[model samples]
Target chain A: MPTADHATGSYPRTARTTPTRAAQRASWDRERVHGILDDGYLCHLGFVRDGAAVVLPTLYARVGERLYVHGSTGSYPLRTASGAPQGLPVCVTVTHVDGLVLARSAFHHSVNYRSVVVHGTARQVTDPAEKAAALDAIVDQAIPGRSADCRPANGKEAAATAVLAIELTEVSAKFRTGGPNDEPEDRELPHWSGVLPVSVSTGAPVAAPDLAAGVALPSYLTAQRSTNA
Target chain B: MPTADHATGSYPRTARTTPTRAAQRASWDRERVHGILDDGYLCHLGFVRDGAAVVLPTLYARVGERLYVHGSTGSYPLRTASGAPQGLPVCVTVTHVDGLVLARSAFHHSVNYRSVVVHGTARQVTDPAEKAAALDAIVDQAIPGRSADCRPANGKEAAATAVLAIELTEVSAKFRTGGPNDEPEDRELPHWSGVLPVSVSTGAPVAAPDLAAGVALPSYLTAQRSTNA
Candidate 1:
């Protein structure tokens, strides 16, 4: 029994997007997908190399339905996308573990989490206008108003970077919340059973050793102190 | 210039273990490798399916040089691991992002993170003694002192779970810390430059809806609220 995403159109579930376990928790809603992507700045990128799979941690940003990831032009995987007739097939995933569900039975122990998985063929972004725009979105994703605060890339810097665009066509988000699901027989066990909520918090800002004088922490960064990001 | 692990002989760096960028931040020390692995409970498992790479988010537990991951016997990837003579070729990576580096120049903006990548052949754990130990370690990884509190898996439940062990023979840890590395010319820009430290914290515990009477929150869980998990 999948729940409907009343806020936005649902992405059609495909063979790859279907959930294997806890089917009820899976969602294909566009708004739910975008919300998960927006809350996280890092992603795990999976790609094939020499017939074996390699997973790398990379920073990514979402703009509308397109996700952008940039790397050094010399990187091997980025080179694989440049001349391919069919784009490189990739899987991008973002996960946030919300809490730990401690159950009386070890078999039922689980974690509360929200995750979005995007499967698609990614291609190199060549258009200058789109590439620059994608870069800005990447910066803004990290800091809400960062792109405007930083200096734009110069010609030399732009030429040295490679950006890939992956359209959010086949996407699915899965989430689990609430307390432990201990079995009926194990309910009276002496063990403690509950949910320990987990969150990512931003600590105090540390200025750069070489930061120029008279430049203090901006209001935007200060505001982050109170937020969960 | 890689640092030596004074206690254990450092894993020799091969072309595959070396980083393409920021080579100075890469370490092959065994202690460093274990530190990063012990700090994170989740990992991204990458494997090839139908000639395309797929990455799945999974829970992982590390015991010495061996890492364990388990799934249902009916899962697609678990089936692939059981029958193969040479086992499944996979990459397991765990990452912890410590901070966001906001620089005056977009090119220098980066994240402070610690990550470990392990590449090897993962084989199904068939030994009953090792299997039981691995399962306990998996539970303890998510919550310290948890395995002792929960009921051990019954014969029926144990039969349904499949665990894989990957040797940590080829591993590398990479990290970036401190403030942003803006170019010298961009230092005087009005944009604020600093490091926003990030950490995972546990919130107040929520008891199960059907929790039996008189099962108070244990000291172990209460202690978690004060620590950054």
Candidate 2:
């Protein structure tokens, strides 16, 4: 039985979004998908080069149903994406490993993780307005409400950057939580079994050595310390 | 000038491993590469399927100059790699977000991260001895010294699993540390800029509801909590 929420959500199931293995963990819920994407700013962007595969770690931001990836115009993949007329086929994946599951038997050992995978054709954003917004969103993705604090990009900087936009048409989130699913027979083994909770921790922020005298820590940043912790 | 460690090393640099942008951050030192790989077990494995790029988050372990990826025999990539006589062309990437950098200007905003990218061909481990070792190494990757604590995999369980090994010959580690590199002119902007230190944190372990009465929390796990912190 699939654990997908009642299947009547905004994102309709596609052939590729369906999972053959762990079907129950796959979800097509749009709100659930958005929550997963919003939780993290970093993602692994994968694309094919020549006849092999290449995956790069990059920053990303989600706006409505679309995702914007930050890159330099001089980079190989982004430069190619800017010139491709029909857009480049790509896959964006975000994952958070919540805990380490230690089961009685090694076969049942697993990690508690929530991951969102987005697959679609990505094209460079040429419009000045959208590109500006995308760049601001990328900054805010790392530090919420930060775009308004910094000086807007100059023309030269904007021209040197590339932003690729991909929609959330083909997406799915798979997650595993709680304890390990050890086999019934293995439960009696003399093994210490449990879940070791793991999470992203933020330490005290260190101000820039050259920060101006009048500047102070932003309230949004202090708020994030608790929210993200 | 490229910041690559003086040419001579255990692993030679290839065309793909030489980074174009931010060449100063790329390093070919074998010890540095191993340090980054040993820090995390999760990796994004990329491969081409049906002419489109597919990237999946998977568990991986590093043994000397080899990397073993955990998967089931029924999984798509593992199944294909097993049948291909010449092995499957793939890229395995691991990343750690050390800090979030906030710059005075939007263009200079960045992340402090350490990442290792390996481009090579992966083949299934058919030899039983190597397969067993790979499986144990994977368990230890996530939780050091964990393989010995759990019940070993039975023959039936081992038959259903597949371990893909890829060498570290064409590998490079890219890292960014310290604060953001705001442009000289933007340094005086009235913005509080700095780096928010980010890291993986472990919480108190929660014992399994069905754990045997005699079993107790393992010392190795407690040791990991402080080491990983």
Candidate 3:
């Protein structure tokens, strides 16, 4: 677990101090922060639209206690949220794969995953430097070394993209890892009861068809690989 | 992918025939259903709470074209939506992990994942038989063989759980898989590149401490040692 004090000035004003049953798994320590953010690349953002609850899947990156999410400027919720009076009250979640739980019974079976959920108001990041940094975080989050691979966003392209900054306050992380937790009586059943570990590994990079012939794969690209946490 | 046909009489009435650009993906088909659902065990269920958007994480199961989700009757939104005047509108989403793309350039870096989003109104399932079946489906979804392992829910237990069923209608699935697609010129950068495949697998079973000394593990539990999809 990462130390809570590290949050210091980076902590959002609304960060929750009292932990609840759902949030009892682990404190939002630094390790927890990086673990949840680095392991998972996607997040589900929940917000209100037209008096209804809407959850949308989007890409996100975590920098310290702040999370950055970008989407097309034309997205309704993003557009509306950027200009909303109270900003957008949003719930953002990230999850990482750890293992699978093959319990003795279907009801007992579950997946092993690490997830973090943050509740906060998301405001559009307008400062050019901030926006650039957030974009880099988002980019580095997906592909660690790819930030320098492509051309930087031009002013027009940057203008067309909407970036939302959400301080990681009032956050909770819950994780279910390790093997199956089977009921006692069913232990003697005739079946194979061991774990079959599932893992993700990088394969050889495939160059884009449009790439020039002489371009060689970057060391960052070739060195990128998965590691067991 | 499972067929869009519904086993129960209930079907989506206002499903869109064609998915928009936002909802559309490079890979769109029924065959991708199980893979997407299996990859993501948790989903964000959106519902209106006091005219505000409330999205929460919940466990779900996919049985054929139907997705089953349930929670305690004491939960706020579930309780409220069950008795609401017109039922609550909801959007459910599930996503799977493929790999992490560590690109040299931030803009070009990205993650590869498979996701499915279902948009529809959630109608309270009042039919006792259907509710029970839905619960079974939920359990089966978590663990394929566990449905038969544990005792069926008694009437009291059944009453305590609120289950909602949604047909896989008005559904859209999107996926981005494979290594990073970096730009041409940055290929020679010293940074490493390539995909880090991510996956979830089952581990050894852990029995609850309160169980009797010699309880045997059920075959259903034991057989679930590997990833199903």
Candidate 4:
């Protein structure tokens, strides 16, 4: 797959992309931004509705610099997409808390995380080929190589879903790692401080109660268990 | 501790609180809402700024129906809080992805999750006593029994932080569980179908490289390892 930024290899910094705090942790590297977005399957999507800000948790997939997200046609955000000119202004963010940073002082405690924020207008995908490809990408993103094994959405099901494509125009990724930054004066304080590493891990696969008699668990899922370590 | 609504024990539903899709997954039960909020440490806070929507990922604490979030005074959303009347109109959401449901058909694949959305006006918390307690709640929410073990924030540190408290007025919890609901005809397709359970797991704690000679890991930290199972 082509990278998010094919030419310059880095995204231009915008006013909104700049980090105000811990500016050292922010990056506008296109590859880094794509990496963070690809690592997580879920994102919090924020958009304006009736002049009110609403944030919804949803699944998304990125193909190059374009992000695809879908929902039922009956959903309010999707319903409003057709009426909005050009597209609906939206902010999408993906975050993974890597660890809990413990410090001698409560004020200094923080979490180690990697996050990507994208600001762009999302327009409802209308082209049938693009919609179908986006849907497949979305499914395969959740489980690698799963799309080929499953049946693609039929015409009726395709009409029931609304997919939005947001081009990544302004994007930034921020990350923090390593140990706590405690004050020098508090160095003598007898407090246990460290990092408790955290991750989203997968457990054993639970077959459906009505799974066919002889079908075996796919190697893709068994492969995930090893990588999960 | 007083519950959010001790008498009614439920949040009133409005058009915004209602789910347009998968309506059966929506619940207005206050306890359910509180449970979802308490289980997560991070939240996406959405608020309008300069006629645009801004969503930020931040740490939050839930004390009864009141959600407390804090950030640097210089932060954009924190700065906007003081200007909005009564408080800043905000939407706070917490979500936990429990499992990935792989279906025989790509369109039927989904995720099991529990999410809570609260819409309300957030007022700047100024009372020193309330602010102190909320800070403790926020820290302890990350690790139970942690606040008493660490040094409390000093005056200088406290002054730099801005806390906003939002009353949980319009709240709703949505959940999806069970195996994938594949079409009856696709049930016999030669494809793997089931759920891959996912969870936030903690690895062994890594003590700071510059830790004091004899400072031991607290029992609370040790206890977490067992519960993390």
Best by TM-score: 4
The DockQ-based order of candidates, best leading, equals 4, 2, 1, 3
Please provide TM-scores, in order, for all candidate models, with all chains considered together. Answer: 0.94, 0.95, 0.75, 0.96
CAPRI classification of candidate 4? high
Off by over 4 Å in 3: A1-34, A100-111, A177-204, A209-229, B1-35, B38-40, B50-52, B99-106, B124-128, B154-160, B177-229
Instruction: State which candidate, 2 or 4, has the greater lDDT.
Output: 2
The value of fnat for model 1 is: 0.83
- State each model's CA lDDT, in order: 0.83, 0.87, 0.64, 0.85
Which is superior by lDDT, 1 or 4? 4
- Model 3 over residues A27-114: C-alpha lDDT tens digits? 5555666677776556888887666566777888888768898766777657877788678888787665555455544444555667
DockQ of all candidate complexes:
0.76, 0.81, 0.32, 0.82
Across A67-168, the per-residue lDDT of candidate 2 in tens digits comes to 999888877779879889988899999998888999999888999888989998889999999999999998888788999999899999899888999988
Q: Rank the candidates by lDDT, best first.
A: 2, 4, 1, 3
Clashing pairs in 1: none
Error of 1 at A190 (Å): 0.8
lDDT of 1 by residue, B1-229 (tens): 1335334657667776888877888999888888888887889898887788878888889998799986767666778899897899998989988888998988788898999889888898878888888889988888888898889999888887878899878889999887887888998998888888888888888888778788888777887542223
Listed for every candidate in order, the interface RMSD values in angstroms are 1.2, 0.9, 4.8, 0.9
List runs of model 2 lying over 4 Å from the truth. A1-7, A224-229, B1-7, B224-229
Cα displacement (angstroms), candidate 1, residue B79, comes to 1.2
* Stronger candidate by lDDT (2 vs 3): 2
Q: What is the TM-score of chain A alone in each candidate?
A: 0.93, 0.93, 0.85, 0.94
Residues A98-209 of candidate 4 have per-residue lDDT tens digits of: 8899999998998999888888888998899999999988887778788888888899988988888888878889899899999988877899989988877888999987
Candidate 3 yields a Cα-based lDDT of 0.64
lDDT of 1 by residue, A78-190 (tens): 78887685878998988888889999998889888888999988898889899888888888887788888888899898888788889888889988888887888898998
